[model samples]
Target chain A: MQEKVHVSGGTALSEQDVHSGEIFMTEDSLDCAFAWDTGVAINRYLTELKNGRIIATECRHCNRIMLPPRLFCELCFKPSSGWVYINDTGVVNTFSICHVHWDASRIKEGEKPYLPAVIEIDGASAGMGIMQLLGEVEPEKIKFGMKVKAVWKPENERTGSITDIKYFKPI
Target chain B: MAILERITRNIDNRFWDPGSEAFPVKNRYTAGMAGQRFFKEIKENGKIFGSKCQSCKITYVPARIYCERCFERLEEWVDVGTEGTIYSFTVVYKTKSGKPKESPSIIVAVKIADGLLIHRLNGCSVEDIQIGMPVKAEFKPKAERRGGIEDIKYFKPL
Candidate 1:
């Protein structure tokens, strides 16, 4: 979100005002709270994650398989034919080293930076991938087209979230 | 393509949470320089202050760093008195939701100190409020103050 300058006009306060925690400073939060509908596709996908599996959709008309499956085939312009279990093993399509968090806060020194990438699952059609994180690999060792496999959490500990598969590691 | 005909019968409330699904994003706000002093004065000292623009010679409230009109750097802090005359007012009888308020509220734009502060007026009924009537700010108790606009509870007729 873009920031608007109030009448304080940027130069109004001193650094002490922030650090001092004196008379003026107040701590609070604005909640952008709302319920999200994960829909038929993601709901089933997340449910499968809890069971230590990956689900995909097959478009019978085009024979294209999609990971993180969707109910409708954008290409075929119709509902997908059926569900298909995808191999959690896949090849890293592309990757990047993230130095900052979503809030742009610096990733502190000594903490490993996150490795974010898209992995093209084995059973999904070519070029179809799920964006996820990489683990158990050094920064310099990761490469494009590297064979990787999802590391699932203990079955009982799994939640219906993408984090159910802790991270993808080089196979 | 109806993926699975068997799954269709039980799809009604399968994924939707009526209200439990809240994605909470946290945020913080910092009162800038001019605002810091303004809120601090009321919270710590229970006094209202404003900054003076030497170029325009106008003492503006909610102390500003730069003059809006002349763009002059305002450095002089003035003790803008809390007491001011009622410049104008409105008797609001409805809540934000368009429902009748439990009691009619008197909101006033008071010409106080060097500038004007718009706040709710208390200790009087709507008929007792009038233009040019003197009013003074009643600040919140020190410990409960958080250095925001709420520092001043409301202005009341003196």
Candidate 2:
């Protein structure tokens, strides 16, 4: 014998069919927490940030000095060659003016749009860049290949985070 | 050994480093098929409904589409009473963000027939709540009703 399935309300499956006694709906809230280890290279990189210095790891086999340092080279499949201090100045590779917040909420009236940009660090290999916020310049005036420098927060206020370098401003 | 010690020393006492932090995530959830119907009944009709498994003769509060014991599809729906007895309770003093609230909130697991309904308890003090205490759901006014368990403001002493 064939099994029969009966759904609440009627035989219709559309969302509109849920209007009255048909479809019952409810909402629930859940919270999850996690802890992550940043490991060796990044640990040292963040430490350098506290001292107001920018550093990168060099991949000996590939001859590339990468920022936001990693212990192993993705391209060469080898351990990093060594650590090197890099200049805080960089050139903007690309950028966007966002009117929406990270949570998708609309920016309130009179607030400036967030400016995020990809910056190619001066001492790293060509085409190597990291995404960071851009500030102190009008959105319309920002241009590709614009020279910028990291604006460091006061040493006492620095917490060894990317925010330690407050933002990149046009030089 | 020297290099390893240097690396470890650099990382020591850096627990409060903002750079070494993980981002928090927020998620929203929707009640499945059976829950949708159960909440709807309470919201629209001011009534509680349960799903019954004909095979096992078991009914589930806040209805489910299938029976847990018999693994049979539950097709029959029944109206359940709003009055129930408190099976368990707790006084919550902290908000989700870990901040303490000005006043404590009372949460209760109410035992109706078949299963339990967990909701906030109001109109009673923390000192007054007890196991097996009889209570009835107090729904929001009709004009204020907007479905979900919150449609019932809370359960109160009968």
Candidate 3:
């Protein structure tokens, strides 16, 4: 029997807000956030605390691991054939200081004005990483290739959530 | 795509909920008291507020606990005007429940007085609203406020 599927049509631009300096066309500014994918359900990693964990699917063919855990492997065009446990400790491969809280609801509720970083987990292959919050490290002290380790919640307190590890810290 | 689904029907839900049995129950996220109070304010008051950086004049709409500009802890709150302009927007044709509403809901990025807010646009037809159009914030009915994002309902043209 054949199965049915629903495909969402691409969204149309509903509005725009443009600003420009009266004196110069070079100063034109446009700011917009597309009303796309407001809600999503992605597979997240489980940590010792109630913190969420992010898992990576490894492709046996290429021995490549994918983070943000997708179902397929891009390297060998193969589906995820296996799963691997990743070490919580990693280095700050790259990071950014978010000066603005992008979402009003989250910001008003006090979700922003924090740093978001992408870390290369220890023992995880290159290109396999997790995006998470870092604590104990000041914003000014954060630097590229900084050694850090996951501070997992105590064994008795762990609940297979990312919050299990309160946050990462310098090694 | 159809072929993929036909072969994976049995495993679809399994793959979707690998860590389903943990925390606050499956699919449900719990917030702290502060978060709860924040949403309650949105339901009760039509106004939105952001944290103001004491060091810098930057205002974060939907306030932040810390200053984004100066990396300072911000404990003060300031109310932004309920009114703002549409920064960007889109009309959603489908909803999660499978049943579609008669009118397409317009979701917009509205620049409230202090910061930008993303919410649904109500009170007017989607055609009537345009980018850079002025709008005012309004609360959903008290009974309809679910202590969630829907609490504010949507922004409407002023």
Candidate 4:
């Protein structure tokens, strides 16, 4: 006979007894929430975006104009000197034709593949670029150093967001 | 000195409120080691297993590999009871997003002789469920079992 231990107020089954379908087991869900703060620099950068203007923070020491503006110069370890408005026109620094969406979902047949690119804005400083979507040009025609310009949403629809610039189109 | 003053004047003092912007995320989780074994036992064998601490002589449901009280490895496994008493419970009237639920869910901490197992309560009204009320685990049909807590649909009055 197999050994069995009885709990004070419950019946305990042996390994063999449980294997015979005398015991029971289950699964549950959990939810999480979060709030993120976009501090001074990016907040003003977005506000300027709503007004159809592009802004970058200039670091007086290093003399570099950084986009997606930072409150401080990362290299100089000092507060940014000031903001400078730059032209929307830029050059495509690099790009990719993505067959899958940001969430990794496959694009359907007959739908155009998304063209995401890093665009080096015309002013501010060399190598200062921000990632944005490429549009209004054939995927095969896009190339490094190709000039592109911002295609803004109607002014009334602008929400002071990166999406305010609908996409970057070949100039 | 003039440049420093100009920089100070350029800094915007107004802060943007949270609802003005949106960021969304999705995550996936996997069960590991002891949890996989416990769920398999429930799904494949229709059994409930608990880990027993040889040092402290205490057993835990939703089996753990180590004992919390003694900090000892719990290698001994035991089968605990299917029926248990409600140790505590709460009625969830709102969803995680703060929306009211059409029908509230009763979540309970059930006390088996071994330890407490938290799960949902069913087949009884929210007003009828009392602390210390005896309830029995109700497993989904064997074919419907997925080796998770949902394998046992919910606990009902014994």
Clash counts for the predictions, in order: 2, 3, 19, 9
After superposition, candidate 2 runs with Cα above 4 Å error:
A1-39, A154-156, B1-11, B16-33, B40-48, B55-58, B65-74, B80-158
Better of 1 and 2 by TM-score: 2
The TM-scores of all predictions, comma-separated, are 0.60, 0.61, 0.39, 0.67
lDDT of 3 at A21: 15
> Which is the leading candidate under lDDT?
1
Model 2: per-residue Cα lDDT over B1-158, one tens digit each: 11232444553634343333444444434556777777778777899888888778777887898889988788899998899999999999999899999999999999887889999999999888899999999999876776677888899999
Q: What is the interface RMSD of each candidate, in Å?
A: 4.5, 4.9, 18.5, 6.4
Under CAPRI classification, how is model 3 graded?
incorrect
Give per-residue lDDT, candidate 3, residue A119.
Answer: 87
Which digits, one per residue and each the tens of the lDDT, describe model 3 over residues A1-171?
A: 787677843533222411211111112223222222111122233321234344555677787766655456667676666555566678887888675644332444544457778888876678566887788877899989888887766767875445677778888
- Model 2 residue A149 lDDT? 97
i-RMS of candidate 1: 4.5
For model 4 the TM-score comes to 0.67
Which DockQ-derived CAPRI band holds candidate 2?
Answer: incorrect
Residue-level error in angstroms, candidate 3, position B108 = 0.7
RMSD of each candidate?
Answer: 7.6, 6.7, 21.1, 9.4
Sorted on lDDT, best first, the list reads 1, 2, 4, 3
lDDT of 1 by residue, A91-126 (tens): 999999999977789999998999999999999999
Q: What tens-digit string does per-residue lDDT give for candidate 4 at A42-106?
A: 77788899999999888889989888788788787888888889899999999999999766899
Residues A72-146 of candidate 2: C-alpha lDDT, one tens digit per residue: 888968778788999999999999999997678999999999999999999999889999999999999999999
Candidate 4 lDDT for residue B31: 45
Chain B: TM-scores of all predictions:
0.81, 0.83, 0.69, 0.81
Better of 1 and 3 by TM-score: 1
